[model samples]
Target: MTTSVRGDQLARLLGRWHALPGRRRSPDYAALAAAVRGLLTDGRLALGVRLPAERELAEALAISRTTVSAAYRALRETGHLTSRRGAGSWTTLPHGHRVASSGLWAPDDDLDMIDLGVAASAAPVELVHAARAAADDLPRYLGSSGYHPIGLPELRAAVADGYTARGVPTSAEQILITSGTQQALDLVLRLSVPAGAPVLVETPTYPNALAALAARRARISTHGLDIDHGWDGEMLLGALRQTRPRMAYLIPEFHNPTGHLMPAELRERLVATAHSTGTELIVDEAFVDLPLDDPAMPPPVAVFDRHSRVTSIGGMSKPYWGGLRIGWVRASAPLVQRLAAIRVGVDMASPVLEQLVAVHLLRQSADIVAARRAQLRFRRDALVEALRDQLPEWRFRIPGGGVTLWAELDGPISSALSRAAEDVGVRLAPGPRFGLDGTLERFVRLPFTLAADDLTEAVRRLASVRHDLDHAARPTWRTPTVIA
Candidate 1:
């Protein structure tokens, strides 16, 4: 009933495992056990995959047979592996443990789970008042057919005036409201890029965007964005020239997960390059208003857009609330009309009530942004301090103005750690979920939107799991391999 993993295949996978930077004191046998357990927990080592024979693995890893014996014993004792004399050893989950699938949005039923995946928070108090005001104003639209695909005129004008105030000089005709940014992204890709055309994306981007593009069957080209250094301008330009993709999607302002803001000069360069290369640049600014510390962030990337090649998508999900479901696209009037026409076959139009509430919320953008920033700053600082105190081995940068911190672990075990954390009621989105080809095994995105106490408790639970992995006892080699 078990599938065996070849010695060479196991060795190849194990070669990528590196010890946590500061843990030189940990014994080699214990480290090996931890690494194997991590792979099992993360689903990389499938349940019932028989491990290589003890002597074979020892020789392949250049370690002693005794050490391999000790490591395998440790794995069996921890319930990550089971062994028998004739059947060999196989991987498995620990008793009472289960894997929880993660996504960009968490399910409403996850109230008992401590969510470290989503970077969203509760709706503001102003939202309720706005909803009430919207209800009062809803009657004005009752007399009409209520099928404004281009958006309610008042809301459209307000969105345009907002962009113009920020120096983009937009008109109501240049705006098209959608259900949310995800919808805006979908409509853009469906209308502009042909099915087989190439599209560029920044690596470690929003997963839903990747999903949307993949659904369109668009050939995806990627440019890596560094957590420490922001986007590589020359590399992006090079890719633009080489691939000549029909569209390039970027999250330049208060970038999600990484929290790296694109500089004004870099934004200008990107806009110019996209124009010259005949590529439409789609900038997602969902997190633009969620600045934590810096008050002097650059203007929207659309400010540098002269040729109308750049389209900006802004949303209320992150800044105001995820439940609002209000987002807009800013592009040329003709393009907006085309997108609106395409949207007709979709939902036709976003709900009138939500749009009315969005108008009220947009009118108070500054105050809302300022309040969210202050609260987020507190949460971010608290989470950072907790990590330093409880889990110093985990390394991460202090993000300036975003809801999440892209934390790097000591080894390629993020998925495993996430699995372990789930047993203690903590849910995480592992590093690979943010990457295109499952390359970021050593990283995890931790959102700071939860309360300070919840963040502390979540880290505590994770530290406990790490401790157990480090100190679990080695099992006897003669026990029968267990399937459950």
Candidate 2:
């Protein structure tokens, strides 16, 4: 069955579309067609999503049925939509069109191509041991249908204990396991955030989170995060109070790209602000286990959420390996059940085998985290030294703990740098990908997840690209496929 978006939902998502800044004066049908095309390009109107009937949408937008019919006809002519007499129209991407889902880290066969684009790590020996243990434990689940909409009991309890040990009170009933943090985030957005509802996020936050927000067609307000001075607590609180957003998504622990950890005082203030504003806080802690400099860890953001307004998402992707496909959400038992209910219509649940392995891995998390931190520290130092040696003009603060560095360039040529770096076999995640509407042009995310020597080589190649950029033609605008 086709997933259909209601006319009211479409109207909400397209708020002020007709009066958007810089939109040229055009006929109503033409403008409507252009807005729908923009949504497709932005990955907000997903491929295969059925559009509302022309009459229904016309009523929603207060436009004539003739105008809606013209708009639908225009979309069909441009190959953006398909229709049938009885079946409604659905969206499609033209040939060679790229969107958010195109970006994922696959093991590259080309040794010549160095992917600084993806921020992930190789699996350690512990994964192998865990898989074997899971295999031995598999028979116990063999008699069942292998469906676990919430998660396996063992993994949920282990995850709950982890939070409890980290100074947050949690129970297994509160944990909702997922395929990855991405899935957990998607599910929460579906359950909590309404279409066109205001949602607060960091200016240069995680790109995938931005993509998820787009997919949900959320109205996003942003707070800036500075590399030198972590967060502007005043600005964050102000946005919460003023916008009164339905939800706020934050990555305070080893924040992506910038890698600035939020201070305990700021987190406390943030929770209080959320409470006062009646806004739910969605805290992403995937990087919490990878502290490189041994900084005193702050309590999880959920600790201060006495009303259970905070939902914390954790996964084995960063601290362990992305290939594991195990992630979870910690919230009130009621919310967990709600997520599971919504999830049943989606994938139903993550694989039984993956959850079993996660149970074993979580049991040995302390050792796993220690090993990752040590390895990452060595690689981080190598990257820092190489950047200083090769490209002295590029400046960045070494992250306390995270897979990537948010480096500032002397000019707003990050997109150009990315294009040029590709010629020299280095793939980069340009700063614009992590920002709203092509902002953050003077920065780029450099992942230090590779081996120490490989990280050094990538920087050397980037230095060469900078030298070439000095003499090359000015670059044109292009939204490249995402990798993070």
Candidate 3:
């Protein structure tokens, strides 16, 4: 079934479409077409979704129907859109331009290139050993159907035991295993939010999480964070009290892009405020296990909530291995039951063998994470050093735990730089890829997930790309995008 995008919804997604810095103003029609193209290329607006009517979109954007008509006409000529007489216009890509790669997907053709697009590390050797051991345990379940609606019992207990050890007092009944945290979030969004419902999220969060919210067609409300500064209490409190969002998705443990860990006091306050607003917090703890600074890990976010208003979502993907594709949600048993029922209509269950492997790996989690942290610390340091040495003008804070560095460029050239870096065989995630709207142009996310040598080389290429962009840039009003 084709998803339909409404006029007002398309207007919000095409925010400030005509206000691109450093480029001369084009006709409104041309500018509108370009913004739609960017959304398609970034996978924010998935192809094949039917768009709004020209008159409806024009009214929503407060533009002339002629301009919207011209825009849609141009889009069709370029094969970015297709329309039938009765059927509305749907997003479609031209033949050659259709092969888009996202943060989760590496282009199959770009095997030799460096990918700083994804913040995932290579699987630890321990995972391989766990896989071998899991094979031995798999035969025990082969006699039965492999379909586990919620998850395998052994894995659920292991994950629940993990939370119980961490002070959350979780039971196996509260755990519902998923294919990954992405799927976990999808399930939570399904249960917790309805279309056009207010849902709060950070300004520059995990891109995939934003996409998930978009998929649910949630009315996204934003709270911002700075890389140098952490969360803004006043802004967050105001958002909660004003929007009174139905749900809020957060990454308090080790925020993606920016590695700011929300303080324990703040987490407590936020949880209380969310409860007051009747907001359910979907806490993403994907990077909670990788602590580079060796700081004491904070208790689970759910521990701070007295009302049981928090649902903690996590996976083995970030800390252990993405290939495992095993994750779970910790919530009230009734909610877990609801999630399992909802999940049954989807993929049904994660792969039995991968779940078995995750069970073994979780048992040995301490040693695996210890080794993983050592490698991350080394690579993070190397990436930081290379950036300082090669591009001193670039500003960033060394992230204590997460795998990425959110760097601020001297200008709003992040989108331009990402494209130019392709010539150097390095793929970079531009800052706006993490933004809710067309923002964060002065920043970029660099992952230290590569080896130390590759990290150094990637920065070297980035420095070259920055140097080239700096020379080619034109004089313009470079308005800084403020977080919060």
lDDT value, residue 47 of candidate 3: 70
What's the lDDT for residue 165 in model 1? 86
Against the hidden true structure, what lDDT does model 2 obtain?
0.85
Give lDDT: candidate 3, residue 3.
Answer: 93
Q: TM-scores of the models, in the given order?
A: 0.78, 0.80, 0.84
Encode model 3's per-residue lDDT on 363-458: one tens digit a residue: 998898999999999999999999999989889988889788899987777765776676677877778878776678889999888899999998
Q: What TM-score quantifies how close candidate 2 is to the native fold?
A: 0.80
Q: Which candidate wins on lDDT?
A: 2
Q: Please give the distance, in angstroms, between residue 47's alpha carbon in candidate 2 and its true position after superposition.
A: 12
Residue ranges of candidate 3 with Cα displaced over 4 Å: 1-40, 43-106, 470-484
Off by over 4 Å in 1: 1-111, 470-484
Candidate 3 has its poorest 10 consecutive residues by lDDT at 475-484
Per-model C-alpha lDDT, please? 0.80, 0.85, 0.83
Q: Residue 344 of candidate 1: its Cα lDDT?
A: 98
Distance from true position, residue 412, model 2, in Å? 0.4
Ranking by lDDT: 2, 3, 1
